[model samples]
Structure formats: C-alpha cells, structure tokens
Target: MKNVKLISLALSMLICFVVSAQERTITGTISDKSGQALPGVNVQIQKTKKSATTDFDGKYNIQAQKGDVILITFIGYQNQTKTIGDENIINVVLQEDNQSLQEVVVTTAMASKKRKATKSSTQMVQGKVAGVAISSGYVQYAPSQSIVVRDVVSLSPKNEPLYILDGVPVKSDQFAKINPNDIQDVKVLKDKDATSTYGSKASNGVVVIDTKNGIYKNLTEKELDAKLNIVHPAPTPNQEDYDAFVENAFESPKTAPLSTFSIDVDNASYTNIRRFINNGQAVPKDAVRVEEMVNFFKYNYPQPKDQHPFSINTELSDSPWNTKNQILRIGLQGKNIATENLPASNMVFLIDVSGSMEDDNKLPLLIQSMKILVNELRAKDNVAIVVYAGAAGLVLPPTSGDEKETINDALESLQAGGSTAGGAGIELAYKIAAENFIKDGNNRVILATDGDFNVGSSSNSDMEKLIEQKRKTGVFLTCLGYGMGNYKDSKMETLADKGNGNYAYIDNIQEANRFLGKEFKGSMFAIAKDVKIQIEFNPKQVQAYRLIGYENRKLRPEDFKNDAIDAGELGSNHTVTALYEIIPAGVESDYLNQQPDALKYTKVQETANNYNDELATIKFRYKKPDGDKSIEMVNVIPNKTVALNKASDDFKFSTAVAWFGLKLRDSKLISNKSTTDILKLAKQGLSRDSEGYKAEFIRLVESAKNVL
Candidate 1:
C-alpha cells in the first residue's frame, strides 16, 4: 500500500509540472509616457529566441510560459522588463531615455547599437559591427563600384535594402548602376524604422541615396529607364486593371437632345491618378475619369431652404480651354447632418486577408485606416468583422463601437494569407449585416481590399451579380481599395456601383483620414439613393452639348424616370458636380463635325416657348434612403454667360480640374492648352482652401507637368 501511494503522488506532481510548463500567448500594447503608441518596439522572452515586434498600433503577441521574463526595448526609450503571470495581457508605458535620444541608434536583425551622431560615424562602424557588412567595389550586376551593405538576414528574396535614388524607388540592380562618384549622401533604415515609413517593400531595410544636384530627381520610371539604359525582362507586365472607357462625344440637339446619367460620388480615379503622378509614373490614359476628378473636391453651394435632402446650384461661364465655347456647371450639396443626429449604424468590416494583400501598403495601411475610422465611431454604433482568405469567416461578432479596444484588437490580430474568396466573404458579411439590421439606420458593409479576388466567383461580372442581389436586403456597400500592382479597380467599382455605395481608393493614411475621419458622416450615412440627372438642352438656345467625364455612368433618357433603374447614392454632406461644354445655337465648331440632315418625311413643328433665354432644363430624380418611389426636382439654367476670368472660385477651380483631366487624357476636344495655362487657371481658383486639398491639386498639376 505504501509503495502504491508513493507512485501515485509522483505521477500527480509530474502532471502539475507539465501544466505549469505549457506556453500561452502573451499579448499587450506598448505606449510612451504621453500615451502615444510606439510601433516597432521589440519584445523578447529573456534567455530565449522567441520575440515579437509591436505593430503600427503598438500591439504585440508572443508565446511564452508563465513566469518567463519578457524585455521590451525601443530606440530612444528606456528598456522595460516584466514577468509573465496568470494574466495573458501586459500593457507597458515606456519612458524616454534622454541620453539615448541624443545619440543615433543603429538597429540590425541581431541587435541594436547606439553611438554619438558624429559626422561619418555610421560609415566608420559599418563593417566593424556584427551582422553588418559594407563593401566598396564592382558588385554583382552593378556596372560601377558602389558601397553595398550585406550580411543581414534578408526578408526579401534578394535580401538587400530597397534603394530610393533621389525620391523614386529603384531596384537593387538599378541602384548598382549609379556612379558612386556622384553620390551625395546615403541613409539606411532597418527593421521597424524602415518598414514604418515605406511599408512592406522595406521589410528587409531601406537605403536612401541622394545624388549631387539630384540628377534623377522627379524622373518618371520610363525616363529613368531610358536615361540608365536599363533593360527589363519582356515577360514582366504591370498587372493593374482599369476598365477602358471612351470620352463622351458631342451630341446634336436635333437628334439626342437629352443628356442623362447617374450622379457619381466616387473619387477613386482621381486619387489613383494622383498616386501615379506622385510616384513619377506616366498616368495611364484610361485611368483618368474626368467626372471623378471634378467631383473629388467639394464645391461651395447654398444649403436647401426647403425639405429637399440636397440643394442645387448652377453657373455658366466660357470654357477655359476653348474661349468660344460655354461651360455649364451643376452642383448639388447634400445636407450636413451632425454626428449626434445621424442614425445609429450597424457596420460589418468585410476585409480581404488574402496573400495578395500581404503588401505593407495593402494590409498595414488598411489596418491603420480602420483605426482612424474606429476613432470616429460613436457609442451607439456597432461593428462586426468578417475576413476572407481561402474562405470566409467572422473573426469578431457584432460588438459595440464603444468597445474600441476590442474592435481594434480584432483588427490588429489579422494576418494576410491564402487565396481571395471575396464572394464568400461578401455573402457572410451581408448575412451578418442583415441579421443585425438596423431599420431606418445606417447598415453597411465596408470592404477594404486590393480587389484581387482570385478564388470562387472572382470575375467582375460575378461580383456585380452578387452585390446586386445582396443590395436588395437594404445593406449598402462601401468599397475602399488599396495597394498598387495587381489591383483590380474594375471589380471594386462594379461592386460599389451595383451595391448602391461609394468607392474610394486609400493610397495612404492621410487619404483614410480624409474619407473616414474628417468626413465620417458624409462617408458613412446616405441621405439619398438612386440619384439621376437629366438635362433637356434647349434646341432654340444650344446646338450641341457634350457631358464632360461620367462616360460610363450615362443612362437612357427613359431610365431617369424609371424608379427601378439604379443610380448613385449621395451621402450626408457630400457634393456632386457635373460640367457640360455647350455650343450656342448658330455657332459652328469642329466638335459639331457632321450635323444630321433635316427630316425628309415629316414636317417639324416649332412651338414658340416663353423660355428663349434658357440654356437648358435640368431635372433631378432621387429616392430617400428608405423610400421606394423617386422624388423629382427641376432647375433652369439661364442664358447668361460669365467670362472664365470672372467666374466664381469654385467654378474656376472645377474648370481647371476638368482642363487638367482633358490634358491628361489627351482629349481631342480640348484646344491646345499647355500645362502652364492649367497651372495659372488653378491658382486663380485656389481660394477657400481650408483643407489644403485645393493646394494639393495645384501641386499635383505641377507634378503632372514635370512627369508628362
């Protein structure tokens, strides 16, 4: 009996030891004393190889046994240590290290070293440090002798720092071709320091090289290639896809007198075009949607004095590109509802976590964008998260918006992998949204993706059908596009258009702030849906008219009155603008190339109407957020025309934007207007620039000039 008891006791103790030795995930957030989250901070299990780095939100998770000591370290911050216990969460606030702040800290994959920020100090310690190798000579694939850094474990296949020659990103092979003698300065950033700035492209590291006089500055990729004689492989091609569209042609009042189309609130094309220009690349002609470019900026319009959801304004001026032609501007401003008065929201974040979204710009930037949106959420709002990879799944159930930490934790835990099953994810998200439907409230599914849907039901038509069917459930969609290469813009645009939603491309955090932060109500709450615009050009006053941009949004004249036909949705506080180039009656131009012959069989009757001074009759049809029937409004544009130089700032700015788009598209209709002309016109309209968006437009125009 004694011997049996001893064996039983020993086994019980062994079992207890095994339970204590098991590892569990330790997750926590690290912030500075001022409560700012510190990203790229290193957290490691002391005496063990297990470690993790805090993400953009300063959240980290690592596996370790209870009682293991974990050390947290970040440059310019005092190191911290904590012992793991029963609690799985351990939040830390680090204090600044004054001494460390004064010195330059060089971090490598293996460890970090600090030294005085003396001139050429980093160069002197380059090769002396372990895991860092610097060599000067003709390296592999390089034509000239250049300083190359090696020895660190590469996160990329090539395992070298991403080289930024001047301000443009270049491949290592191209970096090597530059003459070392012309080099001005070289700066290297490693680990989080590098990735934080450049995203996933700099996961291995980044080396920014500035040449004397910036010989390669502001050069487009094609220009750089030509200058350097860089031969690229023929098999590689840019995978980004955009729907091809033809520019709208001039229509004769004698034949097609009615100009009809849906109003588009989407601004994706403008930002996407801006991305190309900012990156020093030739803007793709097909990617330029003049309507989106004009509508991207908010215009000054009077508020509605009546019960209408939006107010309409009209202006007439001479066309900037062609002084002989006239420009007509129609503007609609949605009523701005205060955040407190806006209806409660039931939002499902339908995120794509596929392998294609693993890029730093796609996923990481997306997460940061969501965090900004979360900050805008009110206590009454609720959020759910559904992610799609190889398949669709809900990572977080419907949680109150007040529980921001929980929602953010869910966002932070997401990892990009597997093939895209966007269709399945959309179904699941709509189902969740329907189940948690807020009647008369804002119930929506916000999809953030690179739009690279490759799995089941991945085609553009497939997505359009899926979204069209799902939208009947009263659950709207908001498509937020991300990333560059392989980006499927057509798919995103189709989903948004079919689902009664708006689409915006988020290229950086600032854009996210603009769409989801500062303009939260306008981006999230719909005041009107199925908004259509139709104009009856006065045959007595106008001979020919052309609708600028919005080529794909054109609707049949009968479709405007058809309540069943779908159109664009106008969000609260949103503005929509449209321009028309008009040819006055009896005025002949090259655009009105071939006039239709007079009718042979029928006698045309001309009725004398009292509105001889009218340029056009504008009709607007829209449905309330929850209404089935459409409401119609009509406004008349008078025959008065203002000089382009005397037009309102908004009119001048919008015309300038339209002119820029025409220039970029190389539209034959536009008379030969140089970039200098566009710049001058843009500066004239650069008033009421509170957000600096107009100023940014001016800068983009300058950039376009330099690159084009």
Candidate 2:
C-alpha cells in the first residue's frame, strides 16, 4: 500500500508539470472597430519576448501558455491585453486611443483636449506635439512645408508622414485635398511600438487624422463648409513626358531569328509609378516601363561561379494570363562583392541649385541624401561638391572620404537660386571627377536635380549629346531626380542613358538608403558594361514570341557584336529579369498576325524533330569595365513547362508586379488578370522577404484596389 501511494503521488506531480509547460497556438485577427483588418499589428505574449505581426490579411498565430496574457498593440489604437482561455481563436477589435464616445481628441499631457479647426491642420498642432516639427511659409504653388514627426524617414522632397483620415490610410500628398477645417484632431505615432504594425511602408511613422463631419452635431453644414473651405477638391498635378516605344512583336526564326537588346538595370519607372498610385492619380502609360518595373525587385538567382561576373538563370512556365501560351523568364545575377572589397571611388556631387529647387523637397532633400552617401564613404574614397545655378562652380575639391565634416559642411552651405545651367553643371562635375579620377576604380558624377534646365544648353538633344560625349571620358554618371511639378524626367532619363549611368527618382530618405546605403556596392561599382542579350527561338516548338517590356532597350541585331555600340551596365549583386510570352506550336492566336507567307526566293529548312525538346537558346555578351572586347555566355531553355502555381516565388512575384503594372496602365494587352489575382500570387511568392518589401507590395496592391 505504501508503494502504491508513492507511485500515484509521483504520477500526479508529473501530470501537473506537463500541463503547466504545455504551449498552445493562438490564432487571431486584429482589426479596427469598423472591421477593417490592420496589417503590421503586433501580437505579443505578455512578459515574454515572443511576438508576431499580423499578415496582409490582419491574421496572426502566436504560441502561449493557456493562462499567459496576450498583448495586442498597434499604433493609433488603445492597447488590449487578454488572458488566454479555452478558446483556440481570439478575435480583437482595437479602439482608437484618446477618442471619447462622442468627440475625437488627440491625447496629450496638457489639460486642453479640444482643438480648433484652422486653415492648415499641421499648423494647428505644430508646437503642441513634443517631437513633431512643422515648417510653414507663404509660397505660391506650394502648400505649407511638410510636418515631420520625430526624425525624417524619407529624403524624398515630400518627407511627410503617411496620413490616415477617418480610419482609412491616405497618401501623404493627398492630405492637401482634405480641407484642414474638416479635421477634428491629428495623432502622431512615432515610436516602433506604434509604427511596426504598418511594416516598412510605415517606417516613416504614421499620422491618424480624425475628420469633423458627424463628430459634432452643433455645427451646421453651411457653417462647416464655410469654415473648412470645402468648395472642391484640389486639381491634379501635371506629369512629365516619356518617349513612347512600341513593345517587341513576334519574330519568325526562319526570317528574323535573333532577338537582341541591351541590358537595362534602371528601376525609376516602378517607384515613379508607385508615387502616382499612392497620390491617388492615374498612372501615365508612358511611365509604365515593364522592364524597369520588373528589374526593381531582387530575385533569388544564383551568383556567378566562374570567370563571368554574372550567372544566367532561365525558367519556362505556363503563362499566367493565357494557358495556351508559355512564358520564359531569364534572370542575370551579378557577382556579390563585399563593400570592403570594392575599388576606391572618386565621386562628384553635381547639384542643381536653381530657383526651382528652393522647395523643401528639392535641394533640402538632396542635401540630406548626399549626407547619407557621404557617411558611407571610406578612407580610400574621395568626394567633390559642384553646384550650378546661373553658373557652375566647384565648392569642395577632391576631399578625402575621411574628412566627412568638410564634405558635409560644403553640402549644407549650398543655397538655392538662379537658373539651372544643367549642361555646364555636368561639364564641371565630370571635370572635377576626371581631375581626381581613380583609375581602375569607380569614377562617377552624381547629379541631383528637379531636371529644370532653363539656362544655356537646356534642350534635351543638346544635353544628351553632351552626356554621350562625356561617357568616352570614362566618368560614369548617376541622376537623382527630386520633387514634382516641372520635373524633367525625360531630360534626366536621356542624360543617364547617354552618360553610361543609372537614373533613380529619390522621393524619400528610405529610397536614398536603399540606393546609397544598402545597395552601396551595386549602386556605385560597375561589374560589367555593354551587356547585351540575344535569343534564338526554335521555330518548331514555338509558333510566336513577344518580348515583354524592354521597349526602350531594343538594339539592332548587329549591335550585339559591335563593341563600339554602348549598352547598359551591370553593377555588383544586381539582377536583371526579362520575360517573353510565347505561343506554343499548333496554338492559334490573333497576336500572330505578322506570320509571313512562304518565301518565294529561297527554300526554308524545317527544324529537326529533336528540336522539340529545346525551347530557345539565350546568348549574352558583356565586357569587363575596362575591357575592349566582349565575352559571351549562353543558356539553353528547355521546352519543359510547369504549372503557374508550381513556379518559383521569384517568378510568381515578378509576374504579380508585371500584372499590377498592366492594370495600372489599363493595358489592352492584359487578359483576364485582376488586382485580387495579383495579390494572391504575391502572397504565395512572399518568401525570403527579409526586408518586408514583398509584404509592403501586398499592402500596395490592396490600396490600389480601393483607389483604382
């Protein structure tokens, strides 16, 4: 009996220990009171560091003990803590913080809880918030200087916080369209706990704006309208121009066997398109460069292994738009080199300080961005500052990278005035760079401008000719475009294209960090130049093919072998993706209208039956930065195809982006694809998204659905 009792007691103790240590998975959705799901909300196990963020669908699953407390937190909302119970699923509705049952109030330590409506909402609470900074002035064609909370998140000219009006997140630029008097109160979420739930898009923080209508019953509609100046919405801003290029059409292997083009790594079009969508404006068709859009995102292609500076990857899959067609994806991954391994660089800051750049987002943002770049410079690197307004002048001359203070001071001392003599500025910048040129290293001129070239040599053709001539000097160029309203995108693009450099539109500091900091090696160091691609399709296996995007990159067939012809440059760790839509043999489509009649002069040889196993052969040619001759690489694509769902995440995600671009452009070429479809594919392909860019893309697509 004693032994039995002892055994029973021991078993009971072991059971209790097991129960206490057991963990259960808790699944839940975090949403606002209106039932809209919130992405990026933090769900944590109280007293423990374990946490998870709600996905794009506002759903999250976290493990916790049965009795442990679950803490749910999001910016702009009250914190909620609940004890885990028998329920396996817990759904939460977060209440807005500082909001009364009837009135909206921004919480602060002061006794004054009510806010008076004014002409500018930022002005009303400018000094009231501790960390919020506001710069306001009377300027024609420009609104009050933007309100920055805590630190500036974006170096882009419009470094404004993401605005939420009445529980709906709106673009920062759209705030001006909302009457300031209609605003009830504005709450700023600056800390990580508050902004993390919004993910990368909210890295700049968020502003929860409560509007006035229906909040107060005492105010009459007529009085409210008069007070708010709610006469009409603000007019849309004008967009810059782009040279229209037709998409590549199907070519017969019997006649035109070679599809040749220069490699393009510029990603300006994608972000520029994002700017249009976020601002609630229609995307310009010309701004939708499919190749640029696709190349913006990084892929999981393998790095170089041999003597080549890049590795070629190919994938053949069923077309997402049409099952009758197959899509071929070709990717080139540049070798990844550590920043420390990069060659010394000689950089010149060619800044446009014309009167147009006086706007907060122009020269000011440029200065901030340049400072970030300066911070990344090493002892071996050298920098010079050159400015152009009425005339071009060198402010700082070949300062060592170690002397950061000197370079920073020079950048800060620049003031905006005079007309933009862009041509002269380029000449001076190149001259400075050449003077301190780092042979066998990176010698480049960084140009920051609104692209408003109003002075001498302002014409696009003249500027292009000058940049083309300067390229022979071995000084590469990089164009950083800023601001809107009179932005010369066309002129800037022309210069970058002709100058053997890359172009980027820096709208915020996040972009500056992405280009100048995170991607420092790829942005500054050129691994290969004159990179070109030519593909030969097997006439037997494929009936027709259309090169998706790369409209501006198409080169004459003979240009592939001619070393004199200039092509795009590939930087360290850069990836370029191109897609081709193909119609399989025996498939009938109207797109193949250009099929040629039998040749009357010469007999055409039929492809061998064994050729059915091969789809196409991809050939690449590139030159070392200093090499005089081009080296070639070849990749043969198999005829095997995989189901769309079975394709790699890289393939799916790129397709999603391409489809989104199509919808944004309202392209007639788009089949039955929808934004919802794109979102679904993107979610499935959101693998290895360490930077949260793919997740942000999902959110962007969701927002686009509502706005479009």
Candidate 3:
C-alpha cells in the first residue's frame, strides 16, 4: 500500500508539470524577409483558443505549451509553423508562397517573326494575355492605357507598369525604343503574390519580355540584324528656356502721372511659383509676376449690377511693408454666368506630343488635365484634337462633345515622340477652329504644352505675329502651360496676350480640376476682350507711385484709346486686381526725383481748387465679345487714408500676396517682412473660402517659410 501511494504521488507531480507547461505564455516578433515589421500577422497556438495578432510593431504574445505547434500566417506570404520548446521567446520570419504566387499571364509561344509583323511593340501585347489590357492612343505616358494588369493598385500620377526585358528592368519609354521583332516572349505579373519579389515598385503590375539575346549573352546575328533594322526612333532630350523681363521700378507720379496696363487674369505665375517652392528650389526672379499671384485668389469684390460686364472697386490703405507709403487697390469683378447660360463652346485641343514632354509632369498630367476639361463639355459643344511633334497633324476631326467616349479614346491614342513643332501645331489648330467656327458662341483654341517650340516659326516674335493674325478670326485662345524644367512662361503669356486669351499653369490633377471642372465656364468663355485700365493719379495728393508687376503688360498712355490695339481678355466670373504703392505729396524721400526739376519744357496746368480732394481718376475701356468699338467708364476716388488693421479683407489679402512677392524677389524697395506676418494677414482674410483655395494659399505660405 505504501509503494502504490508513492507511485500515485509521482504521477500527480508529472500531471501538474504538464498542466503548468501548457498554460505558459510565448512572446515573439514577426517580420517579412527584408526584416521589416509585419503587422496584423496571425500568431496562434495550434489546437487551442489562445492566439494573438501582431501589433503595429510586429510584436506578439500568445499562450502555448511546450511542444505545442504554433502557426503564423499573413496574406501575400506562406504560412509558417513553429514547435514551442524551452525558449519563451520565438521570433518568426515568414516566407512568401511560390506555388500560390500571383497568377502570371504569358502569351502562348508565338514566333518572334510573327510578333515583328506589328507596327509597335505595344501592339504585341493585345489579345495575347487573359488579364492584361492593352489600349492604343496618344496618352501621356504609354501610347496606350499603361498596359494595366486587371486593376492597378497605385495612387500615384505615374502609375506606369514596370517592364523587365530579358532579366533587365527598363522604363516604358525605353521599351518602346526596343525592336518588337527582337522580343521572344512576354509575361505579365499581377498582384502581390507575383510582384513581392520586386519590392514596392511592382505594385502597379509587371511585364517581363524575354528578348532574343539576354544581357548575359552576345546578340546573335539574327537579333543584331533585327535591332539594326528596327523602326523605333530614339527619344531625344530637351533644353530649357524662359524670357527675361526686367522688373518695373518706382515711377515718379509727378512726371509720369498716368499708369496704363491691360488687366491680366492669368494665374500661371502663382501655380508655377508654388511648384518651385514645393520642390525646395529658389524661385526665379522673372517667374514672380506679382499680378498673377494677386489674382490667383478671389476677393470679396461685389459683382456688376448694371450694363457693364464687371464692377470696379478701389481701396486705399497704409502699406504693410512701408508704413510711410500707402497702397491703392484696383479690382475688376467680371460677371458670373451660370454654366447652362454660357455660350456653346468650340474647342480644339492643341496638344504637344514632343519627346521633351515624356516626363510624368509634362505629358501624362496634360492627358489627365484635358480629360477633366472634356468631361465638362456640353452636348452641343464641338471638340477636335491637333498634336504636334516633329510635325503637326490632326489626330481627331471635329466631333460632337456628346460622344465623350470617342473623344476620350482619341485622347488616349496620343503618344509623345519626335521634336516639337509648336508653331505648325498652332496653325493647324487655328485652321481646325476656323473650319468649325461658331459665331456668337465660345470659339476657342486651348493650346496645352511645355512651351518647347523648336521647328518652323519658333521665335516669340513669329508666334506672336501668327497668333495676332489668328486673333482676327473671332476665335479666342486659352494657353494651358504644363510641365517644368523647360516651361516657357514668357511665350505662353505672350500667346495668351496676343491671342486674346487667358493663361493658366496646371501642376497636378487638383489644379486641373480647379480650372477645367469646378470653373469650366469661366475658363473656357470670355465676357470682355481688349480690357484696358488707365489710372490718372492727381499730382496734388500723390507725389510718387509705382505700378506693382505688369512689367511686360505696360502700354503707352495713348494705347488705351486705340481699340485696334490688343489687350488682355476677361473671362466669365474672372477677377483682376492691381496694387500700387504711392507716396503722398507731403511724404518726402529719395524716390520722388524732386518733381523732375519743375518740368522745364512745359508749363504745368494749375490744379483746380477741389483737385486735392480727388486722389485719382480711374478709366476702364473694353469691347464686347462681338463689338469692334470700345465703351469707356470713369470713376473718381477721394483722397482717403485707412489703417492697415481696418482695411477690407480683400485689401489685406492682396497686400499679403504683394508682400510675399516682394520677399520672394528680395526687393530692395519694400521693407523686410517675415513670412509669419504674411501668414497672419492671409488667415484674417480667409473668410468665405468655400473652394479652399485661400486655405491652400495659407499652406503655401507656411511651406515657403520653411524654404525661404
């Protein structure tokens, strides 16, 4: 009986040991093959209810017993097992599954010579693979729809499918340069199972093309011959160019009593400058057009209430930079017509498909931008496409806007190659516009480019003359500048100015939506043409003054009366703002030139007793869309002074923008002001910012503070 009790006690101890071991805790970390943490991995103890999921850091703890089987599994990777031993901590490294890999589609064996029969390598991809989609058009990136494999997983602007040629990865454009005849086989890999091996870049999809000769081996005679006879043209590089405009200096109001300039509604400078600042580059001095920056954001100016297409508003306040000087704000608010009420549009998309436009920002962005504009077209609207690259050609004839798919298909058919022939492209675009002319309607040519014109009639003078002549056809122009590096702001401004059009720079899709989708009517239709502003400052109240910006837009005092002379065009609901820095008659300083030595040659007219009470007389002249004659309006502003803090939000916001421009140019005229000050002023003016553009401007100011 004693021996039986001892054996029973020993068995009880063994049972206790097993029970204790079964309830122990196991802890470890989980990661992928690259040693990166893998969150959400399942860590379970087999045959038990105890399991834990990896935290964000890939660390996990689970209840397990010694010798218990533990399972760790994650999507896109192979399941792993571990038998818990004496060790309390057991790390795991999961391997991706090979057999269950993302299903890759490959073309059933076709003879290389058979593939060679196609005009382009992209053609070889069509109808061969089950899941792969191949489209053809003059698209921004691919000549087709980026060779998508099923649905793409990228949220980037450049979601180009990756190509691996004969064990070497190549750019899509480079693949286009390779001879189609030299390719032996093609395979497309989709999803993470097949693309994980390529890391993050293969998320969009992958195309593996086996060439006749691998990089490891010398080309066979057949392959060499095929390459030498290939018809693919090599991509050429582009050079950058921009026009230089000297900054306007402060003018002596006593000698030059009048400031005359065409009112500019273009906002290209603001967006382009934003691009430069976001890229951590110093803004080019010439790129800082203050007028464009000021006009980029809309103000609270009242809409026109009478026969005039727009209303004129003026404000005077102490300058933010130099408290001693005063600022005069001139604003023009154009009439806002509902989209349904706007005239029918006749649009010709003058697109540049030159090799220089191969960059994602240049051609691909252009395609997406145009797509937005295309979606906004009405059923009666007409659309045409003219592309220039080496030479100009009509890709799509005039088509009804109601046929959106057909227009989109034509847009997708575009491809970038060869040299830029912008001039010939413009001529062709103008011809097509004239062929489909719509009288008393919105007849306009929307030219989109990086402004790299190389072939015939490429000079600014030539382009100006060509567009100037084309402007007589009653077909207005809208210059949409795209890309960077080689952007020709001067040329685009010149074209828009000479062609009676507006200019806008599109940096990304958000901007594209802003210009083409949200503000479609205003961007495409014009309310007034040949819009000019002439302000005659009274020497009695003002000693000296300078027109901010408009250096390239200045007109002779006599040009304002010449209806034949061309000026800027005002679009529907467009707002133009001009700021002037003036020195009061009593405020003495070095900038005044001492009243120009009392005007030795001519006798000065005696001022009327009430002239000092009138600060300035503002005159505006513009022609109706169909009228050749001009109508004039005049307004007299009394001498007024207001504190910077008491000025209207419109005045304050414009002052902030002007101050930011002066800071960017490092101007010696305006006193030094910090970006923080500008941000503060901008925030106060952020009322009624429903579109969020003003909010975006605030962010830009913050970004500029970091870089500047």
User: Relative to the true structure, how large is the alpha-carbon lDDT of every model?
Assistant: 0.84, 0.77, 0.78
Candidate 2 lDDT, 555-638, residue by residue in tens: 889998999888899999999999988888889876677666787886666644667789988899999987779998888888
Residue 469's lDDT within candidate 2 is 92
TM-score of each: 0.74, 0.72, 0.70
Which ranges of candidate 3 are over 4 A from the true structure?
A: 1-239
Top TM-score prediction, candidate number: 1
In the range 125-195, model 1's lDDT, one tens digit per residue, is 55443333333421123234343344445343335566787757886657767775655555566776776
Clash pairs, model 2 backbone: 40-197, 154-509, 155-508, 155-509, 156-507, 156-508, 157-361
lDDT of 2: 0.77
Cα lDDT, model 2, residue 63: 83
**Ordered list by TM-score, greatest first:** 1, 2, 3
Which of the predicted structures, 2 or 3, would earn the higher lDDT when compared with the native? 3
Candidate 2 vs. true structure, TM-score: 0.72
Candidate 1 error regions (>4 Å): 1-235, 600-604
Q: What's the lDDT for residue 20 in model 2?
A: 62
Clashing pairs in 1: 200-360
Please give the distance, in angstroms, between residue 91's alpha carbon in candidate 1 and its true position after superposition: 35
